[model samples]
Target: MTSKDPASPGHRPGADHSKHNHAGHDHSRGDHAGHNHGPSGEKHGPGDGHDHSHANFLGPNTEMIFALASGAALIIGVLIDNFVGAAPGWLPTALFLLAYFFGGFFTLREAIDNLRQKKFEIDTLMLVAAAGAAALGAFAEGALLLFLFSLGHALEHYAMGRAKKAIEALAELAPPTARVRRDGVTSEIPVEELEIGDTVIVRPNERLSADGFVILGNSAINQAPVTGESIPVDKAPVADPALARARPNSVLAESRVFAGTINGSGAIEIEVTRRSTESALAKVVKMVSEAETQKSPTQRFTEKFERIFVPAVLILAFVLLFAFVVIDEPFRDSFYRSMAVLVAASPCALAIATPSAVLSGVARAARGGVLVKGGAPLENLGSLTAIAFDKTGTLTEGKPRITDVVTASGVSEDELLRVTVAVEALSDHPLAQAIVTDGTARLNGAGIPAAGDLKSLTGRGVYATIGGETVWIGKAEMFGTDGIPALGQEMTTAVAQLREAGRTTMVVRQGGRDMGVIGLMDTPREAAKQALLKLKDIGITRMIMISGDNQKVADAIAKDVGLTEAWGDLMPEDKVEAIKKLRANEKVAMVGDGVNDAPAMASATVGIAMGAAGSDVALETADVALMADNLAHLPFAVDLSRKTRSIILQNTILSLGIVAVLVPATIMGMSIGAAVAVHEGSTLIVVFNALRLLALRNRYAESPVAAQA
Candidate 1:
């Protein structure tokens, strides 16, 4: 069960799986020196001034600034040309020239790249249309067209790049150098030079340089960066060095720490176990970077649309420009109409409609501790009709705790616990570990007497000789043996009641007396029930639990959580079959935390991994990952996706509607200036509409489960 709960519950921010405190990532650390988050929500780090990488349809950094400058010049030129009757003709021409230079800067750069590949795309069409407006002696209108076009692209890119920038921010969390301790001498070396088995000294409040095991000191580690856990996990040497160091991947759980997580108070020395490139944070960066390239269906559609539309528009413009052969019109008027029609029909708004929304939605999800890989998953999440959850780690606490303790009439609770804890301490089962923790805390330093001669009853329980008495702890069947005490009617009834309440029970017997029954249960997460309620409230009603636990236990959890259905006693293949059935007609998403759940997750429309921060398998396999352990993020993610989908549709319909109206209006004698205003105005509308997704509401503020938990 602890396998499902890797991070210790006590060290967790809320001390349970319910709190949103983990949203403060050791991973989402924007607090480090030289990192500033701008009003645009872009996190700029040292050495990462601004990325002017390959031209995004929405430009980046300097391109955005240039676009704004061009807008300023165009506005001044328009004022001089129309309002100031006596203004010098050259003044507006010079201003329009500045607008053209600024507006065409990034567009031409990207257009040149496309031309190099012999691809006649949207950028080329935009440039030709603007140049035609200039050719018709409508220089101010052309400047307005280019200025609006550039400004739209720049603003769209700025808003849409939020997710991409958030991902790059992960790389900035790692320190450039690590202080190495070798042969009692310390020196700072580049983090890349740190290797496996090397010792690195981490000072207070400094980010860890590598994933490694604690060797020298104890301190509180703020693991929000790597684990998305808000509470500071205590770091210290393993109780037994010979054991923890010998195990593989000891960096998992206790005794180990990750790179980029901050150390608190005490300085510590660690033996590096993973190279900087292979650390968990690095893997998340690599995986999500790859996800950015996985294009959404809408993006692919537009790409195909561009291939056909760009060529068709160019041909249509040429035919319209020479329409004197068909219509009784002057070439100048015909050419002017053709250029206006071209500007009207440009797909700039359509091009950015989906990408802008997708980008903003993805970034917003990340900020909320949900990593939405790309647009496809984000779009799919909005339409899911059913959600399948793997029960153990995802829906339940995954770590069993002693919930109820019953004592026999003559036996005291302490006495029963003393004998049982002494016998259970010899076992290595997860249940035994949980029992030891409970007993130790309850005992409060008043220790139990030494026990010896332990003997396990196969398929039953264990018994040990403690102070000349045989103490037994296991199921009721372990009793009524030749020398052991029998579970009387009262004791049997108590056991049955505990089982009916969905707890694993064990009978404690001392000598010839039946001590009592102890009940253990892997409780549901604090917010699990509320999250399910929120999901149903949001119209995702067909919630189901598919678990490897027995039918009884699964049904209990399902009932507690208000799930529509429940299935249990499933093998990995059985889970897959269940998800396949659900996916037949419904858009299904499978959420799980284990590798065993991967098959079923793959079979669903979307795979969401719960508590994916430390699980590499979860990160590699899921379309969306809830970085924090809180179940509240699940509903938040679904709500966000739905909002994003709505925004995308709104932008799409508006884009097409503008083009549809403008195409005919321009041919019907709409001026070039009017077409440019309407066309670019629609483009800006879409960009700003998509940016609304960036301001996500607090999902848990109204959640009763979240509040109570």
Candidate 2:
């Protein structure tokens, strides 16, 4: 039951196959940012001078320490040169050399590695610029450049490390062992040793071992850790097959449980259906782990930008270095100006701008229970122009519910509900149960007179003795044919109207007269309307519903939920076609149940799966999985991604603007020291700007665990 590799198993085909290289990272924290990829997708050979910035050559613990050491040495050298006139000139030179030694240690290692790999990176650019400064007798400027570059690099890593901590926490949710009950004996064992059909006992407050059916006992399960569902759901055994088959499209009682969900006070036993490592939690961890590898659109553009920008900057620096020779200017001045320009236009900030934002966005989304597959989907969700939703289990509650209560002229609404609840409370039919459930909820725990001697009229409805009176509740034809008087015109018209509106109608008769009509259907979720309104407010104007049900039912649900359009009688392939057509004109997102509508979802700009908590298929196939199955979270995801995109744009503007300003300033007498200070500041600024997404508040209410993130 090992988790699948995101890159190998679940990847959508035709994705990028670029040769992505990291600008620099501390591998212990697992950074795989996009940088240094060639447009031609060619592999590097030896001596290519490719930059692989290993900023922490000593170790993660000493990265900042080394930066401080470099600053200390440079400060001491400056003091000797300016304040101590009696100090030997060789003494300041020695101190500056020490500063270079401390700061250039990791840079030197990376430059050598890139030389061996035959590729160039930002590290090579920094080293070359520093050397040019030193060759022009600007030892102080070169030392300061090295010191600031190393220090800024260290600070950037420390800040991004804060965001990665949340991602690492998600991987730790599932336990490594399980208590197995076998041959009437219970024993603790490694989860890997448990096979399908094996019985696992879960005590109160214990996380599940694997995805499985609860075969015995019942308990409320807290699924917020894996599913993002704030409320705990009661788990029970599967219903009897015979009883479940009594009604068509009746909602089956939920019995399937997922790994990593905590059991409540009652101990339960589950039959393992999946290997522990292959559970949905494992796949979520895998997806988040490989997220950086799936480069965002901005990352791809950065890669291409660097492929040309690096070589061009190097050529420009060389031309500047020798340009003064042709005009008989001082060689030292020409060299110093050239070095400053090289430092100014290093593009170091550009290299880190997108990846930093993308990484933080991915971690933030996961913390909120939205599993964004990669940076590509995260950006795509923000850019989506339209969204199409699946109906069953998506827009609607996917089960029957009492929708309306129409009363006679003299009868009050409570009276109709009270009489209906009393009669249906004694019945076992699915429709009857729905009436009882909704009626009880409406009654707000009020006492109701009981019914007795309930009689079932096959193919019609039921009759029960209640409060010393007989009541008949059934279909429209059941009354007139069975010694029962037909309903008056108003009640009759009300029944017909409810039917036309795609609701299941139940006619209530008492005292030989029509009392009222109770209408039932798989009603829309309470949040569906508000969720759609939020989507519209967020600029998604073209909202649509696609369903396999009849046109009337689909349209009815769509109107109830505020969708802009509805399409019914759609097969799986029909849904795909609809998505492709919508995608042809605009960027579209297909939101569905995750498994059944995969093709359609894949056809759109981004595929969002609802309630993906326990389903591996949902996590693997869709671009984003809303683990809670709540439509309310959909808007949260979109809003977060939009915020992420804006932050990335801010970073790009600031990073590139610094370079733009510094280049001209350098050629007009900006010192190499000043250029390096501003260059390093821009790089750190880009990183901190991206980190702002980590704190972006989503629209949904956060649970205690999510609030901690």
- Candidate 2 off by > 4 Å: 1-59, 85-89, 201-209, 215-219, 237-255, 262-269, 402-495, 504-520, 702-709
Angstrom error at residue 629, model 1: 3.2
Candidate 2 Cα lDDT to native: 0.76
lDDT against the true structure, per candidate, is 0.73, 0.76
Tens digits of per-residue lDDT, candidate 1, 370-472, equal 7778789998999999999988878897888898899999888888888778888888878878888897788777778888888878778887888898888
Displacement of the residue 33 alpha carbon in candidate 1, Å: 29
Q: Could you tell me which 10 consecutive residues in candidate 1 have the lowest summed lDDT?
A: 30-39
Flag regions of model 1 displaced more than 4 Å. Answer: 1-106, 134-144, 154-163, 213-238, 248-256, 265-271, 301-315, 479-486, 560-564, 701-709
- Alpha-carbon RMSD of each model: 8.9, 7.3
After aligning candidate 2 to the native by TM-score, how far in Å is the CA of 661 from where it should be? Answer: 0.6
